[model samples]
Target: MKTDKTIRTHIVFSIAIVASALLEPCANASSIVGTKHDLSSYTNSSGQICIACHTPHNAQADQLVPLWNHAATTTQFTLYSSVTAKSVPGQPTGYSKACLSCHDGTLALDSFGGKTPAGAGKISGANNLGTDLSDDHPVSFTYDTNLATAHPGIVSPASAAFVDTAKTVPLFNGKLECSSCHDAHDNQNTFFLRKSNAGSALCLSCHNK
Candidate 1:
């Protein structure tokens, strides 16, 4: 029979092994597990990192949707406006609205899968975009050839159907949305920028200047 000390040592080793298994996935930078988007740390029931944002089935139906897991905020944002701007920006729609579910700072980060105010708290500091968006880059606006032709600052999509010849920067049905610039699942670039903005390369991708 194992002595008391031997039994205690075995239990300690087993617990350490289990803990490592739970954490190793989060250490990998290749996926959402290790990124700032990873909310598995605060969740209690599921170890899945994607569960905070997406669900395979039975997702919220009404808003922030297309199988989105989070509850939508009712905040009517102050969109970017300008007298000289040719693009007629509208209230957040599609993916931009989905992103605002957390970024607008009116909703908690863990309020997902029908769990309102999961006690994980809201995003704060630089990550929080707040309700006022007049100072930010405009989103949820049509970025078609007509708008491109009207504004010297905007670049026309090379293929007309996509933002670039490479189609890396996507337009949702010709509308520029937040996912046009950011990818939530991947963050290899800083702040989840779809591509590096070093020397303003990413900005220049869509902007004429």
Candidate 2:
């Protein structure tokens, strides 16, 4: 059993490495500027472009987040609020700005600086991610006491508290990201989720429906 598990893990890592290399050229800063092509070609519908998340310089440990080139938007994002808001408000948590930096569609897609061929200019985007995030799912809030009270059956603060700790240790501790539910490299489901069709199935992965 142990050997099988190790082999599976190795296979997954190997596959990820190959996929990332194939998509690296597309991640070049130039493409994000104005080069218009099917962005979906690099990775499956999951939006798992290698350069999009990783970087050549100053990449995260083992290059999980990778050395991304674009500057993440430091501005405070408007988080979802309601009586059911189990987490704190307007703080950077969950996948937070790191994930939204691109999905929000406001910051320059290729804003992350990268080594480009000579004579090439910096990449910039005309599509601004508007302030209205109501259309998208909520992010950047603390999953503390309130969540325990409302959705005690589902969310727990234990994972949220480890965001900083997980970075140096296991690297991932059940935190949510676009990939938390969706697989950016493989478009297998309606929303690129890693499993069966989304909607309730995706929610059920984390929550009890």
Candidate 3:
């Protein structure tokens, strides 16, 4: 007994509901906003949370990304290297340096936005990577066809199957970095990982074994 107009209205409403449901997760606030990274405890009356690592103007000029408010670390790192490792990791560059700005534990957490807060101090506990990176996973390394050939266990980044999916490990300018494994803005998975490591799926994304 319904008219064509009524049927169209119901269809439109259903589509709108489905669209909102799909976009909810993406619209949700990032975990880093109010988490320990907030650094408002040491900030001087600036209640803005994102200001800890980002700014609207006067960002770091040398940084690859825009709106970088934090001071980049200068500590020379002892990069991860092993006899079995094929890729040559030179140094932490790009987003890896942005993560190390606070995580390296050499600089004060509140040392951002061109103003160091009073009683500011370095990061502590497991979050502190320090100047030594020998114990951590190798970063800032090329992960291309040559490296994949040397280490047959790893899938080539250029492979269609490897690059087709959204969950795959990302490379920055054809080089793997900390952001390759971790999504700093998202914490849907543990350790801010790009994808859930359940059943070692995240690890298996690149490594065949």
Best by TM-score: 1
Worst-scoring 10-residue span by lDDT in model 3: 27-36
Q: Candidate 3: which stretches are off by over 4 Å?
A: 1-30, 44-46, 116-119, 166-168
Pairs that collide in candidate 1 are none
TM-score of each: 0.80, 0.50, 0.79
CA lDDT of each prediction against the hidden true structure = 0.80, 0.48, 0.80
Q: What is the Å distance of residue 45 in model 1 from its true position?
A: 4.6
Cα lDDT tens digits, model 1, 87-197, are 888999878989988898888888877787654588788888999989899999988878878888777775453434335588886788989888887776757778878
Model 2: colliding residue pairs: 46-184, 55-67, 59-67, 69-112, 69-113, 70-111, 70-112, 86-147, 105-129, 106-129
Better of 1 and 3 by TM-score: 1
- 1 against 2, candidate with superior TM-score: 1
lDDT of 2 at 123: 32
lDDT, candidate 3, 16-104, per-residue tens: 99998676555544566444555666656867677777888999886645688888888899989898998899779988998997889
RMSD of 3: 11.8
